[model samples]
Target chain A: MNAHDLIKEAIAEKGKFDSVYWIACGGSMIDLIPAHELLQREATTFTSYIYTAREFDIMRPRRLGEKSLVIACSHSGNTPEVVEGCEIALAAGATVIAQTDNAGSKIDSGKWTTWVYPWGEGVPQAEVPAGISLSLAAELLDQQEGYVDLADMYAGIAEMDKILPPAREKVNAELGDRFAKLCQEHEFFYILGSGPNFSQTYGFAICSLMEMQWQHCSYIHSAEYFHGPFEATQDGVFYFLQMGSSECRAMDERALAFLKTHTDTLMVLDAKEYGMEAVPASVRAYLDPVLFYAMNCELRAARGKVFDHDPDFRRYMGVVEY
Target chain B: MNAHDLIKEAIAEKGKFDSVYWIACGGSMIDLIPAHELLQREATTFTSYIYTAREFDIMRPRRLGEKSLVIACSHSGNTPEVVEGCEIALAAGATVIAQTDNAGSKIDSGKWTTWVYPWGEGVPQAEVPAGISLSLAAELLDQQEGYVDLADMYAGIAEMDKILPPAREKVNAELGDRFAKLCQEHEFFYILGSGPNFSQTYGFAICSLMEMQWQHCSYIHSAEYFHGPFEATQDGVFYFLQMGSSECRAMDERALAFLKTHTDTLMVLDAKEYGMEAVPASVRAYLDPVLFYAMNCELRAARGKVFDHDPDFRRYMGVVEY
Candidate 1:
């Protein structure tokens, strides 16, 4: 079976339980933080974690009894931490669900329920796997009964490829000017979001970590912007507020009110203003933030005009070693 | 009433509650973060927060009911947020306990149990009201059974005073050299801690904000250190770890181990190594980290002896008004 079908079955089959722990390193666990945030609000113990293999071996949580689900996600399947975490979780009596890119990889040898994604046509095999793996794990934990329509998720994946080509060209045209101006400036950029978009707050830091390459960037909830930090919002501070649904709308309003209090640098990206060249609203603002963030982050990267040139793309954070 | 007696009475009265929500801003809140770390583990929902009066007016938790306690702390009893938060909590039916240094300040106007500290001789009366106020708050919170012993805490506080005189001299003496080396060499410094010290990790940022005074700084928990940024610990990096009890002990070990791995630029101040100087292990290594931090922060102001003649005392990131 294809990677997509395998993932769908695992999402459909996992029984409802008392606790859910999603374990993986970096993006594997990061993509699921929003899902866990939603799940935790439902009064269940839910956690999404990122750890190296050696650290995982020394500090694995106890109990994976009948009511527990341990979702081990690793796009490469060979990632040391994800494999070890899967092994440890299974030995502790927890039900393991492994999402891997390569079906034949050793990660498939674990006792957990396995899901695999194959390299799709024309799409780079590496990126598609992590995104697909995460989408599968999110589907299982999304908890909205009508939301399990796997076909819809698969269909939505096409939205990015169809629209991104034009957005890329449009951004590339203006990127050089923006990058020059940004490089000349001595200021800090602050990204603000609220509610479900709170998960996307991590996006700002990760983008800085992986792309724009600035350590002075920070992301805070929109409501928190009004606190003392607001006083620091001089012309030197660049503000980016996520203007999607989620509860971010209300926070967006508050943020707008705050911006009105001063004549400074506040950039608001209202997705509604962009019109629906994207997906449907039924996707929920919580989930939509990621899509909106991917677009927003892409724009930022294009404006910065920085991209990896290395053929082997060495991760700045290094290999996921134990 | 004497500070110790009033603190004991307040604790005896608050022992009936299962959870607490401590509220303050700036120095008042920074002091409480260390204590709340212990309280959070001992209770069901112990959460302490720092917020401005404006933010409190908006998203203050509604109808606290009888399930919690709100300890509104302000060294001066004049901080607008603490006074307003105390009033809001009282209105919401939660028991509000006010810890302050002034008996006639605005916070005293709230309908909550109050404990005030008398300004001591020689110490700048206005500079550290929150320190004494927090000591009182800690005593009250510890009165609730086997959490923390008040006598031991005071003894530890007293021991800290003795340890400070000599360490303070030594560090202050080296301030010029340290400042010159840091400013001339490093682009940034990352302050780290775990468990109890994690609560005060922000204190390092606050000090860097007040002193360093132009250098960029970031703080993170030790568990989070390994997640991504630890890889950056090359010869150019400067790291400071706050040594405290609880997970601080384990994190200290991990940090020391990490230092051995990447030797060039790591500087660790392990409390365990302090030996008899940091007496009364019952004192909870938590508070000791803060005491040492307060002194180390002085190095920021001494900056290569450049600012010795003209101190930049302007409040940059301190208390703000809407």
Candidate 2:
């Protein structure tokens, strides 16, 4: 059985949980954002908290308990802190579910009560973890409060896989050339998103721009944009608007209007603008980050045009021992 | 009375809570990080959730109830979302404590059942909200599980207000001259911190550099630094390590070690290096953010020497409609 089936089975045997401790590290930590927002927005039966692995180990919020369902993610499967988080959850009598890119690596050892690997392998412009993240959100919400009786969220996954590639090519063609030039010219950029797209805003800013090309950027949520980050607005400061159909769309629209007057440097990629005719309206918002990630691949390629920098280029990352 | 005494009185009347909802916006939102971390580490009786005011207003987690204490903060006390967050918590039958700098602003206009302004009004290099944040943490921890007495926390704050001015002058004389040259030289910087200091790192990045001079910076938490930001480290990448005495110190030390090998552009300001002659050892870690904030005064002043940009220098902030 897959992740959805496994979770359903776990709930059946281990019983319903009172809370959830969503813990992971780095890019893997970003995977928890959508499911968390969904549960926070929809589910009332259970409460959820997302923590960085070391934060979990050190702080140990009292919310984690026997009735807590801990979802731990690590793409590499060898991240030390993530492995430690899994161990900590297990010791606290919480059920541990590990999501990893590698099936038999360190995180996939006997410690995890159940494990899941990447989905949608080799699909153009797709993030396997993001696909799983959306499906997991749908399934959990479906089971919660009987909102919808989804057989599992695999149907939503099938819909996404079918429609996303065509949309990816179209978005790439439309926005890729323009964004690449902006990337070459601008010294600073702020990627903004809200709700479900929050983690993706952070991921694209750090993982794609800073990590991939050594650019300077920050990920600011649209809802909080007016508070502090909006102060950074000037003619030279660029804003990458990652638009989605989440509940916070109104907030994004508000921020965009404000940005238009202060700075002309804006690159918007609204999933609502894309052609995902096959995916239902019910689940489209939950997958916007996946759609945005697909669009980002082209932008990454565009940066490849101006500079000969590799995403793996680093003096200290994997090269030095500390 | 001060914030601690105010909370104690409110707790006496409203009764103790089993959970905490920490709500605020921007700088005020960052102020809650230290208290949240301390409570998460020490208190097993009360669970805590830190949310941006708008997030708390929108999400309305199922856990919030009559048995919950909601701490809402804003400096101006006129931020719309903060007012709405307090309204939401009040409607949920939760006790609300408003922390604001303004005495009679909208957030202070007959809305909050309890409120607090700064204690030491004219102290040099002191953040009123941060001092309150530490005191709140101590009170919450003391009330939960009968942990260590926290009268020492107040004594530390008094020491900080007294000895910090002289130390600030010293640091300004020693590091200020040198750091100003670096600030003038480098265009990009990554301010890294963890646990209690993480919020201040972000505050210094957004409030000081980005807002004050439109300089580029990203505040990376030590736990999340290794994930993506670590990839940005090379010969020219600058890192400002705002070291505080917290449980996450080891993680920050590890990152600092790796950064030393990779980049020549590294700036470290550890609280341990500063002298607080009167502060007791038991509560010094809780007040490290306060120490760092004091040191930041010199850093902010150093930026003043290199350029003339006001914190209020903006094209859109408070000058136009959104």
The model with the greatest TM-score is 2
Candidate 1, residues A181-251, lDDT tens digits: the string is 54346334556676556556645544333233433454555654443335445554556666665333665
Off by over 4 Å in 2: A8-16, A41-46, A62-65, A119-127, A133-158, A275-285, A310-316, B1-18, B43-46, B119-127, B149-159, B276-285, B311-315
Worst 10 residues of 1 chain B by lDDT: B40-49
Candidate 1 residue spans exceeding 4 A from truth: A1-199, A206-300, A307-312, A315-322, B1-18, B44-63, B74-84, B101-103, B117-158, B184-189, B210-214, B230-285, B308-312, B315-321
**What residue pairs clash in candidate 1, if any at all?**
A3-A116, A3-A117, A54-A322
What is the lDDT of every predicted structure here? 0.53, 0.73
Task: State each model's C-alpha RMSD to the native.
Answer: 7.1, 3.3
List clashing residue pairs in candidate 2. none
Could you tell me the lDDT of residue B63 within candidate 2? 62
The i-RMS of candidate 1 is: 6.1
Evaluated on chain B only, candidate 1 has a TM-score of 0.77
